[model samples]
Structure formats: C-alpha cells, structure tokens
Target: MQVLLASPRGFCAGVNMAIDSLELALKAFGAPIYVYHEIVHNRHVVEHFQERGVVFLEELEEAPTGSTLLFSAHGVSPEVRQKAKERDLRAIDATCPLVTKVHLEAIKYAKEGRTIVLIGHEGHDEVIGTMGEAPEAILLVESPEDVDALEIAHPEHMAYLTQTTLSVDDTSRIIARLRERFPLIAGPTKSDICYATQNRQEAVAKLSADADLTLVLGSQNSSNSQRLAELSKEHGVAAYLIDGPQDLKPEWFEGVETVLVTAGASAPETVVEAVLDYLKEHYDAKIEPRLVREENVSFPLPRELRQLASS
Candidate 1:
C-alpha cells in the first residue's frame, strides 16, 4: 500500500492562534480557565486542554461568575458577548481574524442599508456570530437552491459574505446563483473563504485525482474536514473523514492500493502521523508527501496575552 500525505493539511493560523490563546491564558491566569466552546472543532485538541484543567462550556450560564472566559475560534455573536457581560465575566476573544473580517463586512453592508446574504451552514457558531452583527438585515443561504428560494426586499442593494471554512466549488456555485438572481449584488473585496481552507481543499482535490482513496482526518462536527471528504466523494473517489486511527476500518482498505491522507485546518499533525503509523503497521504502507501549496501564514496572540508574556 502507498500513502500520499497532503501538504498544508492541518492546523491553520486561526486554530494555532486559538490554541495558543488558551495556553497563554493558562500561563498567565492559571488553571480553572473557561472557554466558551471547543477552541477548535478537533476533539483531541480540546481533550488535551481538558487534561491541562481548561474548562469547556457551551453555555455562558455554566461559567462561573467573574471567571476568565475565552471565546472559541469560531467566533460568537453579540448576544453571547452581551451574556458574558451580564455574567460579569472577564472575556478574551479567540475568533479567527478572517472570520472577524466577515463579521465586520456584514456590519458595514447592513449600515449602508444593503441586505446581507451569509453563505454558510445554519447554526454554525461562526454563522451565528456573523448574523448577530445585523440580524434583521442578514439572510442565510446554504446552497444554490436556497438562493433560488431567497426573498430579499432590496435586490439592487445586496451583499454576500461566507463562512471561513466552506467548499470552494460549492461556494462559487452559490455565488453564481446569487449574481444571476441579483445583478447588482455586491460581495467582499476578497473571497471570504480563508487561505487555509482553500489550500487544504485544493491539496485534497489534487491528491484525490491520483490516489485510489482519500482519508480526511477530522471530527464529524468539523466543517472543513467534512468538506474535504465531500470534495473527494464529488470527484467519484471513495473518502473517509475519521477523527483518528481509532476510527479506521480495515475493510476500507480492501483492494485499495493508494490512499491520500489529509487533515482539516483544526486537526493536528499528530493525528495524521497516528493514522499513517496505523496504516504502515497493518498494511506495510509506503509514505509519500504530495505538495500542493506552501502555507506560511501565522497570526499573533491576542494583545492581552502578548502583554502578559512580555511582562
């Protein structure tokens, strides 16, 4: 068996920043730190922090009053922030800057009286957060079909933004549908899909063309990981999105000669290694890396963490 690894496979700048923020907060503020959600969608990352005494809470009410609370990289809505404030908890935002950019764009467009169409999955933390910016003005569209059913009051004054992690091809199709329906609709200066998501998906797409099968390393709840798996499937290749080696099924490798392995932006490199090791041990696999892109992006820690580290 041959294993092809995708370059730029795991841990994007946003995930790195979010994890680092928690580490720094622990170093500066000590144990019992509360994070609003899994800092990223990967369970391994969250479990690692749990071992270090970081408390992950889904509800603001669960967080103790006045405890230091950190938001996840997925970003949070104004209502969440207001809830935090009402709880009188000290908070630090760990939202990806790219996600923040979309939120800001929503605000700007809404203030300009433009109807905003958010292209993303419903109920996603990032979408919820972005929608909170201008709830009344923003419309959520998940697919080209949704765009067809959309009813906007002012078609001439409209704009669209997308979640950071989305299938590039699917997003493009939706955007096309939006344009066809609203000729004067505006959009972000740059595509809202972040560099990491774009690079990872591109890598998988390229690798899947050559391999017999593709394995996307990520949790089920991870949007980016799910997209990678779907991308491969769309190309008529068999793909699996597994959290780690534990989820690997021996039957998946039946008559499979080559496997392309990749992880989502939030997945860790260690999980990739574990999967590779599992394949090698079981099937005597030979590993090769498929280089699709060189990612050099890094986001700095939050200002509060920076000051603490410097001090």
Candidate 2:
C-alpha cells in the first residue's frame, strides 16, 4: 500500500496563534485559565489544553470575575467583546486575522446601507461571529437554493461575505447564484475563504484523484476537516475523517491500496504520524510526501499576551 501524505496539512497560522496564546497564558497567568471556547476545533488540541488546566467555556458569564479569558480562533462578535468587557474578565483575543477581515468587511458593507449576504453554514462559530457584526443587516445563505428563496428589501444595495473555512468551489458557485439574482451585489475583490482552507482543499482534490481512499485527520466538529472528506467523496473516493489512529477501522483498508492522508488546520502533525504508523504496522504502507504548495503564513499572538510578555 502507498500513503500519500499532504504537505500543508496541519496547524495553519491562525490555529498556531490561538494555541500558542493559550499556552502563553497558562505559563504567565497560572492554571485554571478560562478560554471563551475550544482554543481550536480539534479534540486533541482541546483535550491537551484541558489537561493543562485550561477551562473551555461557551458563555462569557461562566468565567469567574477577574479570570483571564482567551477567545478561540473562530473569532467573536463585537457584542461578545462588549459583554466580556462589562464582566470585567481579563481578555485575550485569538481570532484569526483573516476571520477578523471578514468581520470588518461586513461592518463596512452594513455601514454603507447595504444588506450583507453571508455565504456559510448556519451555526458555525465563524459564521455566528461574522453575522453578529450586523445581525439585522446580514442574511445567511448556505446554498443556491437559499439564494433563490431569499427575500431582500434592497437587492441593489447588497454585499456578500463568506466564512474563512468554506469550500472555495462551492462558495464560487453560491456567489454566482447571488450575482445572477442581484446583479449589483458587491463583495471583496478576493474571495473570503482563507488561504489555508483553499490550499488544503486543492491538495485534497488532487489526492482524491490519485488515491483509492482518503483519510483526513481531524475532529468531527471541525468545519474544514469535514469539507476535506466531502471533497474526496465528491471525487468518487472513499474518505474518512478520523480524530486519530484509534478511530481507524481495518475494514476501511481491506481493498484500498493507495491512501491519501491529510489533516485539518487545527490538527497536530503528531496525530497524522500516529495514523501513518498504524497503517505501516498493518499494511506496510510506503509513505510518499505530496507537496501541493508551501505555506509560510504566520500570525502574531493576541495583544493581551504580548502586553503580558512585555510587562
């Protein structure tokens, strides 16, 4: 069996910044640090932090008064920030810069009296945060069907934004549908999907074409990882999104000869290696590293952490 390992698979700049901010906070602020949400979407990452005395809270009120709070990489709405401020929780924002950019775009469009159409899945952390920027002015559309059913008061004065983790090809199609319906719909000059998401999807598209099976190392709740598996299935290949080697089933590899291995942005490379090791022990798989593109992106730590470091 042959294993095709993706090069730009795990720990993109945003996830790195979020995870690092948490670690730095733990070191500087002592244990029982409160994070507004999972530092990243991967279970392994969250579990690791939990073991290190980091507490993940879904609500701002859950954190004790004066506790240090770190926002997740998914970003938060201005309302969330306001609430955090009101609660007097010492806060560190770990939002991905790209996600922040989308929020800014939404604010800009709304300020111009344009209704905002967001292209993303409903209830996703990123989508929720972006929508909160202009709740009354923003409309959510997950597909072309949603666009067709949309009732806009001012189609002429509308702009579109997208979640950073969306499938590039799917988003393009949805954007086309929006444009067809509203000829004057405005949007960012470039797509809102993040570079890391785009690169991984492109690599998986290539991998799915050449491999009999595709294995994506990531948590089930991870939006980007689920997209990778979906893309492989779209290419007519059997794909599984697993958290780690423990989730791997031998039945999946029974007739599979060539397997493509990749991880989501939040997944750790060590987990990928564990999966590979399992494959090697069982099938004696030959590893072949596939480099679709070289990623050199990096994001700075949160402002609070920087200030803490300097102080």
Candidate 3:
C-alpha cells in the first residue's frame, strides 16, 4: 500500500501559537493554568493539557478569581472578556488573528449602520464570537439559499463576513448570491476564509483523485477538519474523519491501493505520525509526502501573555 501524506496538513500558525501559549503558561506559572475553551478543537491536545493540570472551563464563574485564563484559538466574544474582567481573572487571548479579522469586520460594518450577513455554521465558537460583536446588526447564513431568503431591513446597507475555517467553495457560492441581491455588500468575496483552510481543502480536492480512500485527522467538532473530509468525498473519494489511528477501521483499507492522509489545522502532527505508523506496521505501507502549498505565517504570543512572562 502507498500512503500519500499531505504537507501543510497539521498545526497551522494559529494552532501553533495557541498551543505554545498554553505550554508557556504551564511552564512559567506551573500547573492549573485555566483555559476558557479547549484551546483548539483537537481532543488529543486538550487531553494532553488536561493531564498537566490545565483546567478547561465553559463558564467564567468556574474559574477562581485572579486565576490565569487563556482563551481558545476560536476566539471569544467581548462579553466573555468583560465577565472575566469582572471576575478579576487574568485573561490571556489565544484567538487566531484570522478569526479576529472577521470580528473586526463585523464591528466596522455594524458601526456604519449596515446589516451584516455572516457566512458560517451556527453555534461554531468563531461564529458566536463574531456575531456577539454586532448581534443586532448581523444575521447568520450557511448557504446561498439562505442569502435568497434574507429580508434585509436595508438591502443597500448590507455587508458580509465569514468564519475563517469555512470551505472556500461553499463560501464563494454564498458570496455570489449575496452580491446578486445586495450588490453593494461590504465584503464581496470569500477573502475572510483563512489561507490554511483553503490550502488544505485544495490539496485534498486535488490529491483525493489518486487515492482510493482518504483519512482526515481531526476531531468531530473541528469545522475546518470537517470541511477537508467533506471536500474529499465531494471529489468522489471515500473519506473518513478520525481523531487518531485508533479510529481507523480495517474495512476502510479493503481493496484500497493508495491512501491519502491529511490532518486538520488544530490537529497535532504527532497524531498524523501515529496514524502513518499504524498503516506502515499493519499494511507495510510506503509513505509519499505531497506538499500542495507552502505556508510561512506566524503570530506572536498575545501581548498580555508576553507582559506576564516579562513580569
């Protein structure tokens, strides 16, 4: 068996920074560093941190007053930040810069008196945070159909923003429809979708053709990871989204000549290696590394974290 291990497959810049922040906090401040969310969507990463005394909290009240709390990469609403402040918790932001861009866009459009249509799945952490920026001014839409059904209070004063981790093709279609109805929409393209999401999907869309089956390394709740698997299946290849090697089934490899393996941005590279090793040991698979695009983006640790570190 031949394994096509994709390049740029795991741990994008934002994930790297978020994980680094957690590790640094744990090292400098000792165990029991409080985090507002999973830090990223990966179960393995969260579990690893949890074992080290990193407490993940869903509610601000759960954290003790004056505890150090880190926000997840998905970002959090300003409301959450205010509550943390009220609780006197020292909050460390780990929000990806790309997601922050969408939140800022929503704020800009809302302040201009424009109704913003956010192109993203409902309940997603990133979407929830951005919508919080201008909840009254923003409406959520998942498809072009949603665009057609929208009755904007002021059609001429409309704009759009998107979750950074969405499929480029899906967002493009929705943006097109929004343009047809609201020609003056503030954001006319899917530029809000992050580069990592677009690159990974493009790689899978291009390489899945040669593989009999494609395995995506990511958690169920990871939006970008889900898109990679769904995008592969759309290209007519069988794809499975698994958290790690343990999720791989023998049936998926039956009669499969070539297997394409890719990891989501939030997924750890160690999981990818373990999955590859499982295939190599069990099936005597040969690894073939394929890099679709090169990425060199990096975000520094949050300013607050840096200040804390210096002090």
Scored by lDDT, the top model is 1
For residues 1-311, could you state the per-residue lDDT of candidate 1 as single tens digits?
A: 99999998999999999998999999988899999988999989989999999999989999989999999999999999999999999899989999999989998999999999999999888998999999999999999999999988779999999999999999999999999999999999999999999999999888898899999999999999999999999988999999899998889989999999999999999999999999999999999988999989999887767788677
Residue pairs that clash (backbone atoms under 3 angstroms), model 1: none
- Clashes per candidate (backbone, < 3 Å): 0, 0, 0
lDDT of 3 by residue, 40-145 (tens): 9999999999999999998889999999999999999999999999999888899999888888888889999999999999999888899999889989999989
Candidate 3 weakest lDDT stretch, 10 residues: 183-192
| lDDT of model 3, residue 3 | 95
The models' CA-based lDDT, in order, is 0.93, 0.92, 0.91
lDDT tens string, model 2, 1-311?
A: 99999888999999988988888899998999998878889999989989989999998999998889988999999999999899999899999999999999999998999999999999999999999999999999999999999998878999999999988889999999999999999999887899999999999998778899999999999999999999999999999999999999888988898999999998999999999999999899999999999999999888778877677
lDDT of 1 at 65: 91
What is the full ranking by lDDT, best candidate first? 1, 2, 3
Query: Where does model 3 exceed 4 Å of error?
Result: 188-190, 307-311
Better of 1 and 2 by lDDT: 1
TM-scores for every candidate against the unseen true structure: 0.98, 0.98, 0.97
Q: lDDT, candidate 1, residue 75? A: 94
Instruction: Give the root-mean-square deviation of each candidate in angstroms.
Output: 0.9, 1.0, 1.4
